[model samples]
Target: MNSEQRMKSEVEIWKRKMMKKSGMMNRITKKAQDKINGLIPEKAHKVITESIKKMVQATLFGSEYLTKPKETYNLSLEEKEALIKDSLNKFRKTAVVEGAGTGAGGLLLGLADFPLLLSIKMKFLFEVASIHGYDVKAYEERLFILYVFQLAFSSEEHKKNVLETISHWDEVKGELVDVDWQVLQQEYRDYIDFVKMLQLVPGIGAIVGAYANYNLLDQLGETAINAYRIRAFNRNEITEEIPLDSDK
Candidate 1:
């Protein structure tokens, strides 16, 4: 086909992927909602929204899927691996120099907000996979974690400030410097648990950040934590909100 035909064909394919008319898309949306409900925190609603926007923006600009989603070429396993590795390394280079910034142009996985510093980095990952793509989840998770850490790790320029900030939680009263290593590690462990949960669903690893977008910031913000804890504590008052169509 000509360039025009190819471009049109790619757009058609993207429309199919973005369209939610089919029940196929409904399942994805439901999963997204469930993830949101499971994760939404009262405090950091803005964080989640920004994160999703970053994810979508980053995917659109940084990923070939948005520009040439339909383009395909035969590559050996090694070649594909090399491509992913290269993309990941480039992203890491920035972190090794500067620290967490907003994602999308600012894209790299925003780490400026979380006082506890919950971050993940999936560098050079391919676009969304399908039911068959679930087998490689661990690599994706590792990539995500490394991508975020690289921000903290490689930030040579802001090394002093980033380190100082990470060492203590800046509070309204004063800087809580000299952070407890144990607590920071615990924070990582907590976020890792959520990452593990994403692996159970096929094609979700790519969109794991997206799925977490609705819940992670809120949970970290402790906005819903209190309410949820209250509901847990007062079982008698719990209404058990359930979606009517969920059963169907």
Candidate 2:
């Protein structure tokens, strides 16, 4: 197989793994998280959910004003991915520094890290979407970014569902009327609660925060790449191997 074919094969394998049934450990964790979520007051859940919803919406709507102009040059998949890797590294360092700084500040700054980190993640997604040749200025492209974010931090069951939608994004994206804010916020919160809770603790918060943020960025980067790969192939943008010299 040629390079594009090989990459397509890898993406298919990743999708299969992503869609697989949750293992015992995952089930156990989900059960525990569910119980914890159950104990929280409904009002509290609503407040948190709405907060995240608005935060994300604000970021999405305002990002166009802040982002660099969309890249217009046609690039082969491999060339596009090289640019993505460099962008990921830059964003990862920003996340790590932000995590460590806030974590070292104890309760107040640690609590502040939520919205801050959320912004960083969203910004990175916007950049990734741009690199993948999607215009985030378009509403549908913005929705795709949200799906990628959800896929990165959601439960296994949710991941499977999101993967299906992403796999058929061309058909599905047009039909997507709105996001389910409750599921988006709850799944994201539950996925990070355990580790992030530790980051709120005073003594080791810095170390925990830095480590958590680094890994989180790494996960986001991988998810964004594969998510775009699914779209790229679907659009026939990467149907054949193209030499690097032809990228210009």
* CA shift of 205, model 1, Å: 27
> In model 1, what is the error at residue 245, expressed in angstroms?
32
Residue ranges of candidate 2 with Cα displaced over 4 Å: 27-51, 64-69, 237-248
lDDT of 1 by residue, 37-142 (tens): 4663443444544543444344333432222221324543234334444544453443322222222212123333232122223222232111112122333322
- TM-score, candidate 1, is 0.24
- RMSD to the true structure for each prediction, in A, is 22.2, 6.1
Worst 10 residues of 2 by lDDT: 239-248
lDDT string, candidate 2, 22-58, tens digits: 7898778767767766765565456456668876676
Q: Runs in model 1 with CA error above 4 Å?
A: 1-45, 48-50, 53-65, 69-72, 98-123, 126-248
Score candidate 2 by TM-score against the native.
Answer: 0.85
Candidate 1: Cα lDDT at 155:
19
The CA lDDT at 234 in model 1 is: 31
lDDT of each: 0.32, 0.78
